[model samples]
Target: MASTITTDLKNLSISEPVVIIGSGLAGLASANQLVNKYKIPIVILEKESSLGGNSIKASSGINGAHTTTQSNLNVNDTPELFFNDTTKSAKGKGVETLMDKLAKDSHLAVEWLQSEFDLKLDLLAQLGGHSVPRTHRSSGKLPPGFEIVSALSKNLKNLAESNPELVKINLDSKVTDIKVEDKKVTGVEFINTQNDKVETLNTSNVIFCSGGFGFSKEMLQEYAPDLVNLPTTNGKQTTGDGQKILSKLGADLIDMDQIQVHPTGFVDPQDPESHWKFLAAEALRGLGGILLSPSTGKRFVNELDTRDVVTEAIQIQCSKANNKALLVLGEGIYEDLKNNLDFYMFKKLIKKITLKQVVEDYKLPITSDELAEHLNQYSTAAKDTFNRPLVVKNLGDEITSETNVFIGEVTPVVHFTMGGAKINTKSQVINKDGQILAQGLYAAGEVSGGVHGANRLGGSSLLECVVFGRTAADSIANVN
Candidate 1:
């Protein structure tokens, strides 16, 4: 509990700390930039009782282009190539300037995190919609999200201890509204859930780092009605608080219907009907995990395709039955994804089983021999019918009836919302008429849109947070 913030409303009249809403990666990163780079004071207001909102649950890694790690691994990748890949996946809704800025500064963002925390993001993977392996993580110790959040939170606490006026973290503080005067944003009004007393903090600038609306029932029903029935990988605090509050002040929202339905959310055997499910990280598929039809016991679609493509394929193929598919991971893949395997197995979301049990328990029409033959095609074929190039070395190199593999049941779930208050590269919140809405209001992270258009590639979400979060702070520094 890093709630080192004071309940002293007396300071509000004299203090000029930049008010940051939310304690997720974007907020923390932007706060870091403000205090460290600009020597500015900040007060982070988190609606949740804990730090690191949805960012703590992130299992996939962060994206970068022309990074030191990529060069060390001899992976030929450039920012232009990364930008082109993002544009292709965005399907025309992505803002050209924002996407270009994201790709260009991606390596700097990765470098900033490593330098600040002394983190060795040595592990790399090639996720969907990327031409090369640029997603960086740890060496399989913990999830990248947890590691980053822990480091950032600890550093902020240390800074607060050194000088309480510099960095303040107020947990369990739910901001209800934005206070404005003279048609310019002035401050924020919030109530600490612990005491239920409302307070106001007046400042020249306000930055919204709150997340998207994936877990909010009312928000989903209002904006993305079709996805209301789907479960989410987001935390309960991710209720679009920033967007709802800011929209009242003429902030223009964009792409309200562009919700991302991830292809794989593990269905727990113990609680299959639970509305909340753990996400099957896309890094597993990047490491050669394959998706098979439960009834036929054969591969149906390319596992490395963009999330939307994979989810649509699963729904189309499994529509006849339970709308579920079997995600299979060979021994090599399980080892590569070791960081996430224990929690997955502990929760019984994934099971360790032999190939024979998979065939018998799933009640497939084909025999064990037929399944082996289909899998062995990966060893000799240049590419499969789905154009899945570069078959992993250990996975499917040799198939046997007694092969030990990890398996899980996966279904489509609402993972990300690509719609929110629209913003430019400078992180200034804009109005519907394409003008800056206020003098001292900014938005970052998933709360601000136009970075990822229709679909978001794996690993890019964290990158967006780091890049835009720091950009918002920089923009404010120039203004102030």
Candidate 2:
């Protein structure tokens, strides 16, 4: 790997550093590997004013198999089981090899972060479509995404401080074009948003981690037209800039039409019509929260079902109603999720109240007697008639008029794009013919796809960023 760096884009005489587009987890991971492990000079460009793209907003945790966190909890899990669960969740649309790679490296990815940065991921939970507990997060008030990104960002800043010429990170620099020569990427053309200046710099490699297009109205309309009108939980910086630039270079995109609509975006009563939504983490349901139809106050779908299934059920129910559903968490669940509950309460997205109080406060149609009967029925039943296990064994039975529960209005929102530029196991961008399109171009994270097919599991997004981001760095480092 090249170890020379040019501080200014105007200096054409100096050798170019390895260029990483986007400062999200994937891009930061790549840079970390390249500079720390390979001792390579690198430059990271981010379109946003701050670093950590949509990754910083991730509420759930990262998935791992047979991790130290899981082992400590006495949970038995393997990569094969994780693979089966992922493939099943993907619904036969995911690429088999990519899924295999992701599952196989799941443990190592978790360990890498723990060993390298000493980030705590001691808590484990079972998300939907998973048979066992595997998603790992720290037992802290701060979410996992913030912990991981902040740690990585601090590490990178330390590297930059020590070796100013070797590591450079420029915020508000957006890559507009890939400069290719002889069918190989050589550099990039970008605009410095601060000064409105256009510049070009030569580089040995370009790793695109610019992220998905969920927030892009034009891209959504073009690819998944049905999802254009839906609200998104993605950051504004996720406008498919990397995909658009790569596609122009003839990179074949796969599954662009497959978008994942997460079932639980908090519909703020203060601004119910806004398209930008704060995602209610899937862990909320995983931790024994139940979804109820606001009109009738009854469970409409299995809360632990796959996200797509739950989202479809919510959409259908909302179509008949006024696009409203209720997420009810028992006292035990609220106690377990005090951090998130307090935040939601501060945002006025959720309220702490008794069952009877909620009914009266929200003007629910169910009578107090009927609501008590319904809760008793759920509590006494071992499992639903459909054979789906209840979310929590004694959740419903524990609810009482004096018991305080957290309740929030939720609706389906556009969450993840399961499709983007096609890539091989090495994270090299490829074409439709199964051929590498550019020798010096690579991609990872949500910017490059085919890993998750029809739907993505709750915690796999962060795992994908770490696993493939490191893979891209390794591939680029090994390049002659």
TM-score of each: 0.96, 0.95
**Which parts of model 1 are misplaced by more than 4 Å?**
1-15
The lDDT, on a scale of 0 to 1, for candidate 2 is 0.85
Q: Candidate 2 residues 389-445, lDDT tens each?
A: 665443555545555678899889999999999899999999877899988889999
lDDT of 1 by residue, 1-480 (tens): 323233443364334788899888999899999988988889999988789988888888999999999999999999999999999989999587999999999999999998988878888999988999999998858899999888888888999899888888888889988878886777788887887878778777889999999999998999888889887788888788888987888899988788899999998889888888799999988878889987678888988899999999998888764778998888887667786988899888898887888899888788887887778887567787888874544455688778778899999999998989999889999999999988888989999989999999999888999999999999999987
TM-score of 2: 0.95
Model 1 alpha-carbon miss at residue 77, Å? 0.8
Clashes of 2: 0
Most accurate candidate by lDDT: 1
- Candidate lDDT scores, in order, read 0.87, 0.85
